[model samples]
Target: MESITEEQLIQMVRDFIESESSAPQISVSSSESHIDSDHHHQPSNIDTLEEMIWRETTDVEVEILEKILMYMRNMGSLIIEPKNLKKWVVLRLKMDGYEASLCKTTWVSFPGRAKGNYEFVDVITNGTRVIIDMEFRSQFELARPTQSYTKLIEALPSFFIGTEEKLGNVVTLLCSAAKESLKESGLHIPPWRKATYMLPKWFSENCKKVSFSPNSNSTIEEF
Candidate 1:
């Protein structure tokens, strides 16, 4: 398979932005056919989410996304476990002169939430911080989805590289949509899927930052 070039990945982002701006038409009949009448009466949350995700890309975000795309394309030959991939990506970014780290966040069980931990990569460029999730799209997928919810999922990028503010907005939109989709299907929404729980996965104050030195074989520091 031919590897996707950085230019190609950047073009894909541009195309996605343009497509979102134009609001591509989605086919609803097939997926909505089995939905309940109450679902049909609900407001269009997916449409609102689609509009929310479409915004002008910052220079920093584009640069980071492009670099991540290149790194991912080159990683195809390596074992692609999430832990190793995240560490590798962080190392690569650091070698390229960017401040990158692996962030692990853990929280205890609290009211309306459960105890859990999550890990992801983040980079700081020119004093701006951006969250990078290699498995972004998969996080929002549902077993059974209404047509509108499916459309919203389709619009999400496979990987997410953006600021905390943008990520917060995305979590809010997707979680709300997910709740509505589950309600429509007569299923319970998993606690982890809720925005309140999901947001802390990245935004927690208790997060530990781990950094790797580019010149060392096993030099890792945590703070």
Candidate 2:
């Protein structure tokens, strides 16, 4: 697996947004909510579990969710996605507190071709159920951020049914852990096509993380 520092990942996201600012090729629309009791996955052991995948959302993904909590206090809403194909975040969007990096489901398999099985997955969040769209990836696939997000949003809803509880209700970027695997296997990943323009100075090289403005000075979270 190729090792990538967090900075490289953030640049990929900035580059993605810039590309979309130049032109719009997105064929996206709001998805319908398929909330059915039969479709929802409620676990029998949920009451017994102490540490849950849902709580991991805030702890694992961003380093300073606590500080982000303070910042969100004033704001009524937020929009976030993992950078560089990494994590998924689910927050209460309430009481000025947030939680992310929630895990919905995980699947393990082979790497790519002959397509025998080369696929392992941990679907932390399904955006459709949550009613949002976001994708995270690294600089290598930096070109088509919008396109990728669009596709994930479209496909996630159908699977909402039949999952264990605590796993459902999320759609975060889960590509980080796999970025190295894909590169090591020499898979030809398409550069995210949506981004066409250069990014702002905040994302210039020699950067560590971007402190989200108007928020408590970047908080070392989601830089």
Candidate 3:
């Protein structure tokens, strides 16, 4: 079996997404899809071949893929592997027309009864203070992740919305302002991709300029 290169994998995804059919059939290398020997679990029922390709993959993984493509056309690739029965995907970003692995992004699931399971910083990009918080649960979720982020904003004076207008609660302040915290933060990100994509991209691009750093209380998970 010829080893599949990172470039080939990236082109596969691009081709899959661009295909005219709603669902396209693409062959994946067994090594790429192979699970660990210790792993013992039934594969979840998949509605599409795309989902089967990344069976253990999550919606978040697809989001990260889309964001990487945003910066470059066919230069990025993703490799999905299992870690302790959980699927982890490593992103290879395009550098000088080639793909290079950054680091393995982990997936942390929580018990439903556990408090604050869904609310925390998911992962941080290597060699940068670009923190991607795993909040964005509905504005009505019981956890209220946005409220948690308010502490980050209050702790650092340098943090501000990505738009030109001043920031505040939309209900009480500047309802008519052209710019808004939610809009600027990409909260209303199109249904086509992850809501958190724009935020990370913004932080990655402005980490140095804004001097953005989360406080000690911020729940940052490092793998």
Can you write out model 2's per-residue Cα lDDT over 1-223, one digit (the tens) per residue? 4533444434433443343243323232444244566676342222112123222333222323233333434333333432422222232222123323323222222233111111111222333122111322122233224443334333222111112223321211223312333455555553221111111111122233211222433332443
Q: Write the per-residue lDDT of candidate 3 for residues 9-93, one digit (tens) a residue.
A: 4554454345313433445688757776888544322223223323323454445546544533432353232121011122222
TM-score of each model, in listed order = 0.74, 0.23, 0.19
* Residue range 131-185, candidate 1, lDDT tens digits: 8886777888998998878987887866677888788888998898899989998
What residue runs in model 3 are displaced by over 4 Å at the alpha carbon?
1-13, 19-21, 24-51, 54-57, 74-223
Candidates' C-alpha lDDT? 0.75, 0.28, 0.29
Q: What is the C-alpha local distance difference test score of candidate 3? A: 0.29
Q: Using TM-score as the measure, name the better of candidate 1 and candidate 3.
A: 1
Q: Give the Å shift of residue 151 in candidate 2.
A: 14
lDDT of model 3 at position 51 = 35
Give candidate 2 misplaced runs (Cα > 4 Å): 24-96, 106-223
Instruction: Tell me the deviation in Å of residue 68 in model 3.
Output: 2.2
RMSD of each: 8.0, 17.0, 20.8
**Highest TM-score against the true fold, candidate:** 1
Off by over 4 Å in 1: 1-54, 72-82, 218-223
Candidate 2's clash total is 29
